[model samples]
Target: MDPILLGAIFITPIAAIIIIGLIWYQKWNYTFKDLQHIKGPTPLPIVGNMSELGDPTKIFWQLFNWQIQYGNIVKGCYGMDMLLLISEPEYLEFICTSQSTLPKGIFYRYLHKWLSFGLLTSKGKKWHQRRKMITPAYHFKILEQFVEVFEKNGNILVEKLRGEVGNPSFDVNIYLTLCALDSINETAMGTSVDAQNNSNTDYIRAIKEMNRIVVDRTIQPHKHFDFLYQFTNDYKIEQKCLKILHSYTLSIIESRRQELLNNPSRFDSKYVDEFGMKKRIAFLDLLLQSTIDGKPLSNEDIREEVDTFMFEGHDTVSTCMSFWMYLISKHPEVEAKLLAEQREIFGDDPKRPTTYLDLQKMHYMEMTVKETLRLYPSVPFMMRDTLEDFTFRDLSVKKGTQILMLPFYLHRRADLYPEPEKFIPERFTAENMSKRHPFAYLAFSAGYRNCIGQKFAMIELKSTLSKVLRSFNICSAVPEHNLVIKSEIILAAGNGYKIQLKNRTW
Candidate 1:
């Protein structure tokens, strides 16, 4: 072979490589110019900033550090997707109150299969119609019926704590979660899951597993693509989980649909039983009768709303209440205040169940719950995609950019809340809250797309906590098991909510 021929072959390939590299650099520069002013951590070639966010358990805190080091509107990446995490109050208010009605950001794509076009995941006309129809289901009259469910479930929880009264400490997360599951299921589906008694039930297991998988998939970028995900074992497990979740939800929908045919007026209005008491109407019963564009909602459509209710209702309340138990335990003064308030409402009869009026009288507990939410919100963060370009805080965000709202850190801002890390229920007093930014505390999120079940969740939490505090005294673990907070699809405690209980002697 001639030396000239060999040189020509090697040189040609090297020249091509240079040309391709230059073309790629030019494209990257052009795209980033719109966001050129935004400051953020440097990204790697393919994974972007995912290496820094490698651990799901610590990603939220990691992002918080980035926000502090970079700025309030920290620009970063999740794999190839750009994520703009906002903590500034003005920016949060603008994004939330304006474009929130836009579809949920990319993170919700994974939830579509399980929750699917439910009020949480739906967008556009579908979301508007569904929101209109679903609003009535959570009416004061309808919600009034759920108080009985809460009390009955709360009593079961109080009775169950008897077995753990003498133990030094145990993870009470499961107890609270199952109790919530039982209560939400009874109200949402009108079926008795009795999750507290049968903790090993399939529905409960599937929900737990699905929660893990949603977080798992979010962090692992490769799983984002269905084509790539289908080849992995997690994909298989996800399918199995979906089968259990959807089948059970659908089964109850069908059962209730058939049951309604026999009664035909269950959803008409809350009817009175022979005992002259108003009967309860489950969330599912209302959805069964609802229609979209004059066509009755299909079973699939009804299941979407019911399943969404289960996730939001049970997971949101349980996580918040669990934190309250831990926070209340750590601050004995807080616990004393809570118990005193309980007495004021129930008049020394702690065993008496709470009514709607009773929940209203829980002014102190309401403030405490609000403060707990500020410290550790039920949903740690909310994600949204901008439908139109917007400018805020002198920063211009492009359309199609993903906005990750970090309520976890927003509420932690020292500038916003003095001694932000401390448990101060008074921070939520009428006077204090009025002085604060409305968007500063986003436990239930903000704006048009805020959590629809907010009132329902508050009622369940206050009633349940009132019942538990009345019967038992919750104390922190002997060795001090600190809650390792993690932001998953919902806020989660990696270490579990560990506490001891003593039978109330008052």
Candidate 2:
């Protein structure tokens, strides 16, 4: 054989082997062996189940249906990526509580970058430090100070409803959103946003824009590629929202800095006067005065914390209020009972908005609110990633595997609550609550990273509902419309909830 011919033969075989090996590796790399045991719908090549997942209208129901088919713990693929959907309470508890094992998922990395290391997005030691620093701000004693703000906002809502009495139809979502915005602004930033007054504040607009962009990003298939965000419209919107939000937060911090400088005594813990009651007003003020290891919070720290609170403070509470109103409108008996409870508590005081002490007395109202959360938790699902190899039900979850815990399904488990679909507030009564698992009714989630603003949100809901129910009778404007539920960071009614407001005769 000629030398050139022999050399060609050897090189051709080597190249063929290399190509075969590369192809084999690619196929193996894309496969998920562990998920073989768990049954799910056949996923399409490349897209996997992403086509089904991207359908915003049917995604939740589709997932719920999958849960029914594949049992509580179903494994599915999304574009070559594996996801474990955990619906069982026990599994959820393990995922949520096992922070040392499971951290927030990589999908949330974008949020972490945008929002900074705040309680909602931060993980590991940083999350712990931030939570510790902020926990005291939400203690019952501190939250009590914001009762008036809640009442004022609730009263504003009532006045708005009263003005529209006999209108036969109106969209309540916008109003609820505005009420939450105003209340959060006053409580969290110590600055009045005047959202209920229809003021188009840049901060409020930006917040709304951010939510819209987030929803768009979630639903749009092409936006899933993180690198592509820079060249997309969603990125532009997100950037705009971030700018307005950050600017507003920084401006508030600067104003507070000036105020602290002008009145050094404002930071004094012993500035009590005649009544012997210490007056530490405002959320920003409290945060500013808070120190860890005797070091004041840095501006960056304040901005991140404030932004987190502001984002959460408005969205979750507002979404809950909107759903609660819709539920009450559908159930007149429940509404009547709520009204009677309100009347019994305040006793015909026309000017009496719920006081902090008064809210404490509204036990029935609390039950109603709890039940509402159980049925329509503003946050339907939460994502966590495995930080280390951990065993769940004898199966190992390797580091970096995404874990999705759906509270929506868990809340509706028939075994946990008989006839779970039935709207029964009594399920949350003290007696009934004691019999269930502590993590079963986790509307605000469970364990160390549970919602810090849960108390404030509860108080705000109770106060607002009491005032609204006391003053007006609300009924759905279009009862026939099947209201679609969608999640874009928070659960919201797809078609804005419309209600008829009638002034209460009683």
Candidate 3:
């Protein structure tokens, strides 16, 4: 036998064997078995049900339809990836409440890179530690201290809107985003970013870019390949955005440190009334003062928490406000009712902004906000990865499988919410709430990892809505406009929310 011929024969079989092993590994790692009994639309290879997700406008509706067809608990695959969609309240309770078994999925790893093990993305022991450290910042008493911040920012928002009332309708999303940014910065960071006045600040710009990039990554399948993302334009944008965000945060941290170092007496008892009383003891301050196991947090830890709060605090609340404003604009009856409630609560005091006490008294307003969140949660979907092989009911779910919970579908389930499409706030009344499952309304999510800023968000929403309603009457400029929702990091309207605002007679 020739030497060349023998070498070729040996190489060919080795190459063939390698190829076969690669194929088997791909199938073993990515593909799911026994999903036939679980029920869902047939998934295409590699892409899975991702093809159905391309159109943002129809994605949520289509997912809901799938839930209807496949029942409350549906199992599907996304490109060789196994995913379980749980819309049932009982199952959701199990998943959310069971902290030890399921952790945030791989999708959250992208967020973890930016947020760095903050409460939102951290899991198990790390999450437990961070959650405890941060819990004090969101205490009811601490939240009470921030009421003035909400009202002041809310008033500023109203003034800004009042200026726009005479002009043709403008996109309310921008204004809502600004109001949220301003509110969160003042209340959470104890500083004013003036987002409404200086909307193009480096921090604000970076945040918008970060949001855009994250959403883009979630939608683009090719970006999932680590090497591809590293070389892609999207990745470049993400890197630049992260740099801008971190730089801005570091500057703030350094400034605070210098201010404290230069005036150590600022912490003294005599200076308590002069400096301490007047000083802003905001969320960031609390985090700065917090310690664990006899050691204070490092700059890196503080940065992570601050950045996490900055992103989560503003975006979710803004998204909620955007949806709530659009809904109010579309439904004149609801708006009118809200206005009437505001008038009744304020009683001819148009200049007086709603206080925390006054806002708490606005039961109807709270219900409306709750209803809006139910209909259009900022986070439409949440993903969890199974830590171990688990069984729910009769189905066996394997480890590493992604569990997707669509709040968009859960909130609209006919079984859970009757007349699901209708904007009925009465359903949230104490009486009606008692009749419904607690997990059915998950706008801020549920269980231990539920939104820590829920109360703060509600306070901001109420104050802004009340003040705005007092000053101006909002109506949709294009009442028949079929506003499509863009499923990004936040649920934004595709074409923006254009609404007409008329200054009130009062």
Predicted model with the maximum lDDT: 1
Choose the strongest candidate by TM-score: 1
Q: If both were scored by lDDT, which would come out higher, candidate 1 or candidate 2?
A: 1
The sequence of per-residue lDDT tens digits that candidate 2 reaches over residues 161-245 is 7777878777788888899889888888888878899758787778777776765666566877778878987788788888878
Candidate 2 residues lying further than 4 Å off, grouped into runs, are 1-36, 219-221, 268-280
Residue-wise lDDT of candidate 1 within 13-37, one digit each (tens)?
9888777656545544443567777
Q: What's model 3's lDDT at 327?
A: 84
Q: Write the per-residue lDDT of candidate 3 for residues 308-371, one digit (tens) a residue.
A: 8888888788777777887888888988888788778888787875566888888999999999
Model 3, stretches more than 4 Å misplaced? Answer: 1-35, 54-62, 261-277
Estimate TM-scores for all models: 0.93, 0.89, 0.91
Clashes of each: 0, 0, 3
